[model samples]
Every structure is written in structure tokens, then in C-alpha cells.
Target: MAVPVESEAPGGRDVVGAVLKACMLLGQFSADRPVWTLNDLTTASGMNKTTVFRLMATLVQAGWVNRTDEGAYRVAMPVFEIGSAALAKLDIRSAAKPFMSDLATTFGNTAYLMVPAEQGAVCIDLLEGRNSLVVAGINVGSVMPYHAAAGPIVMLAHSKELRDRWIKPGLPAITEQTITDVNLLVEHLDEIEDAGYSLSVSDYLPGVAAVAAPILGSDGAVLASISVGGRAEEFEGAALAAKIEKVCAAGARITRIVRAMPRA
Candidate 1:
């Protein structure tokens, strides 16, 4: 009887080339181009059509990709469901939920917890005020532009790298109030860091206003932000100042709670 052996590459390492090719195929999908065809994957991955087709077939069998009747492919529901489940399991969301609910109820404004993402900030959790006439359009999993919203701006103020990358020339205007000048935005970011919060009135939306504070981790790095937003009229004068104070305090408390959790 002859023994079977796994194939080896030039470096004498067992080749799991199929698995690697499958991952490369899946990585081609993105927010901008979520659907792809066999030719696209073959071109993007630099793999031959036969290899791409075989890997994609396996991925579709495993429910990782869905093949359309038109012969195109897209990431299947399982991928998104798994990603959502992972976000739901994060300790920060659990730590911030109570504080967010309290802040929303106390101010009658929507409260949000957002974490930094590759492009902007991702809202992980939110609580709507009982009397809120109109809730902030953002919900959990919303990705906000770094320059257009108070929550993301506060997160950007803490990091020199993020600010440099995000505040490039010709920033997009989300609304009439959005800061478009790079120099002025940098000055405002410095002010936000000094004030320990960012305040925005109709910066992202016409009738909405928000005040946001950053949550720091044990290493003194910003972990996330807590924001309270509502109608522009409600966030005025003494009441607005009070909401800012409360939001800052809640951020501090959530930070402490996050720091106390045992590391994995």
C-alpha cells in the first residue's frame, strides 16, 4: 500500500492554498461593491478562473457566499449575522447600556454609544427618550462621517492620526453647518479636546443638535463616545449646558466600568 502525502510549496510548507484563495475571494466584497462575478474574483485575486470557481463553489456550499441567478456572487446573510452577533457580545455595549438609558430618560433626548471604525464611527447602541418628538435618524450599526457628527468629531479630536486622515482637503458637507475648511476644523478639534466634549447644532442634520463626550480606557486611550442629541430648540442655554455635563459624567462612569472588567 502507498501512503498519501499533502502537497508542499517551495518553502516545504503544507499548502492550504484553497483556504487562502477562498478568503481572498471573499475579501473582494465591500460596501461600495458588494456583488461580484467569476471574472471579477479571478481578476482581483490573480487566481485562474478554474481555482476561483472551485473556491467560490465551496464558499457557496458553506453558506458564506450566495450565487445569484445572473451568475453574480454576494456575501450571504450568515456573514452579517455573525458580525452582528460579535458586536452584541462586546463588553463595552453591556457596560454603557444602563448609563445611556439613564441619560436619554433624564434629558428626553436620544443617547448613543459609538466606537471608532476604519472610515468613521459605528454606533453600537442607542436609547430613545420617552418624549422625543423625532428620534435621531441614526441607529445601532450606523456609520457616521467623522466631520459631520458630534460623536465622531469627539473621537477624532483624541487622535492625531485620525484627524490627519479624515480632515483632508475638500471635506464633504453633510449640512450647511458642517465644517469644510481643514484649518478651521483642526482649530475646532483642538477646542473640543480642551473642552472634553464636542457640541454640534445642525451640523449633520438640519433640525438636530448633539453634545458628545469621549470614554477613555485604562490606558487613557479613547474607547468610545457617549452622545445626547435632540431637537435644536431643546439644546439651548442652561439646558444644553446641563446635558453636556451629564453626558460627560456618563462617559466617565462607563469608562470606569469598562476598565474594571477582567481581560480575556
Candidate 2:
């Protein structure tokens, strides 16, 4: 699991605090104010002059920031490379969006598109249905655990590497229904793989349910997942089955679209 980014220093861990401060310093640069000197950065960020200098020097060394002969700093090529990489990942989101919209409209629930991340899975896009009460705490850019939610579980079921990394002892529980037991979760992932979809109830969030399926690459590798989620009470036997079928179909369609895209 990726260590959580903390704003404050934890016991015997100052790296997180340093990372946070560096990010804060970087935030001061934008199109409007693209370049900054040590004095400007320290004053604008309200950080110690020595700290700002150290951070700037580190960023320059790391190729994330560039320093001019005049001692002004600007974001560097690596930053643009990172941005381009993120935009490339959004291609899958574009391919899956129409199907997600259809799922949301037909089911009167929320449809989510999630892509695998270093830590787990990230919700890249979400379309809300006509349901009166929207499920809370989940929005675009929300990072979900690989063992809990239907989307992440679908991801875990399809990827052996993710399963090996995430399905270990003492998996954190987000709700009472969350499967923290390593053996049981392993069995559950096998079932999900055999079924080619996942049905989750109140696992990640209270009173919420979701059905998800994997969107596979041309080589059959799991690329991402698509899911429909709403109130737990609304998901029952036949209704849940129909949702599973729809979500799986959506996943298949998106896989085709992604495959048809021109390769970079």
C-alpha cells in the first residue's frame, strides 16, 4: 500500500512533511506567475527562507523545477511530461463515459469509471442518476481501496499483481461489511473472477451498493473498471443481477472503444 501523504510530521517521519511543503511551494507557480525567486517564494508561501531555498534546490535537482541564471525558478519539462501522461490516461475515461451515462440514466444510480493507480484505484469520472439522494463522499478523483468497493475489487479480481499486493493480512475495514480477512477476500476475488463481475453491499460506504466489471485491454489485461452504485436497499436479487449484466456489457463496449483508438 502507498503510504498516506500527511501534512503534519508523523512520529519519526519528516519526509511526508517535507513533501507537503515542497508541493505547497510548487503551488505558488502558475501561468500568471510562472517564475519565482527565493525571496518571492518564501514571502508568497509564508515559509522560512532557508526552507524555501532548500526545497527549490531539491526540486531543481529532481528535474521538476528549473532555475534560471537570475536565480528564478519555474516548472520544468518533467512537470509537462507528468501532465501529458495524466492526459493520456484520460483516454479510457472518454471511451467509457457514454456507457456510464447510459447506466446512470437507465438504473437511476451513479456510474463510475475507475482506473488502477499505484496505491489502488482512482475515480476518474462519475455520472449521477436521477436518484433523490446522491451517494456521498465519492467524487471524481476519489481514491478507493482495492479490496472493498466493487470497482476496485473488480480490478483486483482481474489483476494477479494487485491481488498479491493488496490481499494481505489486516486489510483495513471501511465498514462492517468490508472483508478484512485475507483468506475470505482471496476466495471472494476468485468468485468475482469466475463470475466476471462484482457485487458489493455496504462494503466501502454504509448503505451503498455497487456492481462492477473489468474493462480489459487487447491483451486481456485489466485496464480499468466501470461500476453503477446507489442505495443498498435498492439492490436486490433480480435487480442486482440485471445491474451486473448491464455493467459487464458496458465494460465490454468500452474495451472495444479503447482498443479501436489510434495508438500513440
Candidate 3:
């Protein structure tokens, strides 16, 4: 019979190593390797086959892991459910939705809420305006390149560590308008940080123009970015200035809400 490895606390409360071992097993799964065989997990976890099997069985019973027909293990729906529940608890999205909708409607352009992820930015939410011509086909869950697009660039400009890590020796060009020169890109990032927002034309894709501003946390760190994107013609001259003003105002409102909320 398998037993949880336990240690006594100061008050004699038990600390179970088996639960931590099970968490370690789950932590092995990632975007690169989402599934694992019994032997694979056993080797990666450095736990014996019997212990791994017992832990896997317990996890399967709890609906945290699913055993495939091929005898492999993968994260189950319970994990996604837990993640979704946590996301639902975040007030930023809820607080920003009204302003995003109003901004999109007022400007007749797409408004996006982008958050940093793995050297890139992911669109967490979006509201499409009444414009018939779509500049980009991006939606929620779309990953934007860190080196391109207004939202991602603004995020990178604020996050020094992520910028240094992601910006390498050679910058890849997605479009002809994309900034391939590292020095030029660095200069642009500096301008963005000073101006408190980013405005770009055809930087990520042809015929697209965008303006973005950072949403700051209570500690004045970049929490995320809000961007408005549309056709190139709509982003020129006085129209561009109007868009910048509205986008910055919306960003400021969202930042204030984020700062007021208690950290989770």
C-alpha cells in the first residue's frame, strides 16, 4: 500500500510530501509537451514507477489528469475549469469592457486588451467597431509578436527584462514596414516610453494602423496595454490625434481601476 510521506510541524500538523510530489508531476506538462507516458513522467519526476502510478491514479480519480487509451496522461478539463474560474475573478476585464466598447464605438475601430505572455502579448479581449473594412483578423487569444504591433511594442517598451530577452541579434521582418533595425526599434521604444503610448502604421501588417497606451499597476508597473487599430487612412493627421487622445484617456481610466483593486 502507498502512504503519503509526512513530517510533523511545530504544532504536530502533518506536512505531506506526496502532495508536493504530485504537483511536481503536473508541473512537468507544458505547451511543448502536453502529454506524457508513465515511464516519461517517472523519469522526468525522478520518482519510482510505483509512486508515480499511485499519484497518477489519485489525480485521475480527482479529475485533474486523464489517462488516455494509449496509457498516456494529460491535463484534464478540471485544470482548465480552475484556470477559467480564476480569470473570471479578475476585475480588470470586467472593469475595462465598458470603456473598450465605448472607445470602439466612438472611434469606429477595433479596441484590444493585450497582456504580456512568453516574450509576446496575448489579446485577452477585443471589441470590434462598425467599420466594414477589417485591417487585421485578430481576436481574443491571438498571440501578437513582441517586436511588432502597437500593443505588444508598448508592453515591450515598459517591460525592460522582456524587451532585452526577446529582442535578439536579428529582428525578423513580418512585413516590409516592420522595423528590422534593432537600433531603430530601440529608438522607437524610447519614444514610446517618453510619450506614454505608441502609434504605428503598417508595423505588424500591411494597411493597418494602431495607437496603444500602457495600463499601469498600483506600483506604476505596466500591467497590460489598450490599443485601437484601423485602416491607414483613418490614422493620419487630425484623425490620428483624436484617436490618440481617446485611447490614452481610456487607458488611464483602466489603469486607475486596476490600481484601486486589491492584488490577488
| TM-scores of all predicted structures | 0.64, 0.65, 0.64
Question: How do the residues 62-181 of candidate 2 rate in per-residue lDDT, one tens digit apiece?
Answer: 999998889799999988776556556668877787899999899899999998998879999999999824767778888889999899999999998888778888889999999999
Error of 1 at 52 (Å): 73
User: Cα lDDT for residue 192, model 1?
Assistant: 97
All candidates: CA RMSD in angstroms?
A: 19.4, 17.8, 18.3
Tens-place lDDT per residue, model 3, 1-264, is: 122323332323474677777887887886568899999888787777898999999999999999899999999998877756655566878878988898789988998999988847999998889982465557789897888899999998888877778877688898888887888888888889999899888888888989999998877777899999988899998999998998898898788667656566
Q: Which residue pairs collide, candidate 2?
A: none
- Compose the digit string of candidate 1's lDDT tens values, residues 53-138: 98899999999999899989999999878756655555988888888899889988889999998978999988889877565568
Q: Give the number of colliding residue pairs in candidate 3.
A: 0
Look at candidate 2 and tell me the lDDT of residue 3: 26
Please list the residue runs of candidate 1 whose C-alpha ends up more than 4 Å from where it truly belongs after superposition: 1-90
* TM accuracy, model 3: 0.64
The lDDT values for all models are 0.84, 0.85, 0.83
Total backbone collisions, model 2: 0
TM-score of 2: 0.65
lDDT of 1: 0.84
